[model samples]
Target: MTNSNVFQNLSQESMSLDQVFHNIVRYMKQDVIGNYRLIFGTDSQVHTDHTLFITGIVIHRERKGAWACIRKVKVPRKMTNLHERISYETTLTEEVVSLFSEEMKQQLIDIVLPHIYKGASFTIEGHIDIGSGSRNKTRVFVNEMVSRMESLGLEPKIKPDAVVASSYANRYTK
Candidate 1:
């Protein structure tokens, strides 16, 4: 959503975040045979000249695996703390989800959220890059990040459980 060339198609076709959302929704509407979950996440890698941040939105269909849309953004600044980096990652994921929600409001209300409200086993979650290993200092930010996601009305996911952010998106950040 930030007017930076932050997102691209798998074929390396560049497009704005709004275009990406519309594309995803078009796919979703065409492939509406099963239950699905919309997951958002972000990951970052620091290089010599800049830090790369990648955000992903994953559409998971029960018993059918998933597919994702990713966006990458680079910043010249560097981050030193686990909490700060993780927090920024959370913000990126949140922004992407916000735009998705805005674009898909009617569809979500009439289709997805209703299933969730009726006790369907579907969810919309935000994944954070923090892990639980003692060797991982990012664990310190897990509680705060989880609370933040909850406040945003999303279920939260952390490392191990957050492959969409920490793994899938991480591939492109580098």
Candidate 2:
């Protein structure tokens, strides 16, 4: 919801949306053109007085390597309900995915749009923090969240499978 770009890379410098897109393009063209997946996901941690949210964009090149950019924001409001909290996390993920998808579309239009899902082989997926295999209360919202993501044309992945959100983003949520 914040207007300013606040994502930071673990190894390099922080990046704006444009920078992220350019980096991905560079990686795709120089490192792995037809073998990579772009993923967007979010996770959150609720404290007594606030909530910390982390949204991550991961670029994974098949058997080669991976890089991710993360944004961490602290909301003054606290989200306590399990369902509400999980829903909020999914919403955050959606926001990031929307922006990312738009940027990537513009960048890849001339490069791979005509050959989408074919020669280029670039993929975009959304990873939700909720999963069916967990004892966590968020499991109940898996179906709803996945359906929403699917409606947006993003392949949805859940915990165990959605390490981008559950594991990576979660690591920085605190």
Candidate 3:
């Protein structure tokens, strides 16, 4: 298994965590008076010999537009166990979120602190790829994963609500 700080999107590649932080700051600064959300999530695809995990980081300007990037991690062996795979995805998401230092977060928060009275706000969310649908196999793990997100002081999202993990990250996992 390998872990790296590099992240990339269609417009940029090989961005260090500091660059990613500045990119997020630049986007938020564009319209400080608007509402915004930061989301982090991860999805994985297991191949015959290894598993590829993609963690997506997105900063949404709430219905206007969003800036997103992803970091990939490759585990040197196939991971077919459902619980293990799901747990790893969540772990990856958490790992990426942890890279943002308290000061970095404060930088983003400070951008909106002044405009809060005008309805501007900022929120952070963690999207876990699991779901709670009774018929879904991942249902059993929903509570555990959501609790993990909550412990990080983030809003937890799953399945239908977790498009970042289930949708954005999943698309490039191949």
TM-score of every model versus the real structure = 0.83, 0.86, 0.98
Give per-residue CA lDDT, model 1, range 14-81, as digits (tens).
77766766665665555455476788889999888667789887777777667577877777766666
User: Which candidate would rank higher by TM-score, 1 or 2?
Assistant: 2
Residue ranges of candidate 2 with Cα displaced over 4 Å: 1-3, 101-103, 109-120
TM-score of 2: 0.86
Which tens-of-lDDT digit does each residue in 20-130 have in candidate 3? 988999999999998999999999999989999999999999888999999999999999999999999999998998998788888899999999999899999999998
**Mind giving the per-residue lDDT tens digits that candidate 2 earns over 1-174?**
343466788776678888888877777666433566788898889988888889888888777788789877677878788887788788778777777666566665445555555645667789998868666777778889999889878889987899899898989877
Q: Once superposed on the true structure, which residue ranges of model 1 sit more than 4 Å away at CA?
A: 1-6, 112-122
Q: Model 1 residue 121 lDDT?
A: 44
Q: Candidate 1, TM-score vs. the true structure?
A: 0.83
Q: For model 2, what is the alpha-carbon lDDT of residue 169?
A: 93
Q: Rank the candidates by TM-score, best first.
A: 3, 2, 1
Positional deviation of residue 169's Cα in model 2 after best superposition, in angstroms? 0.5
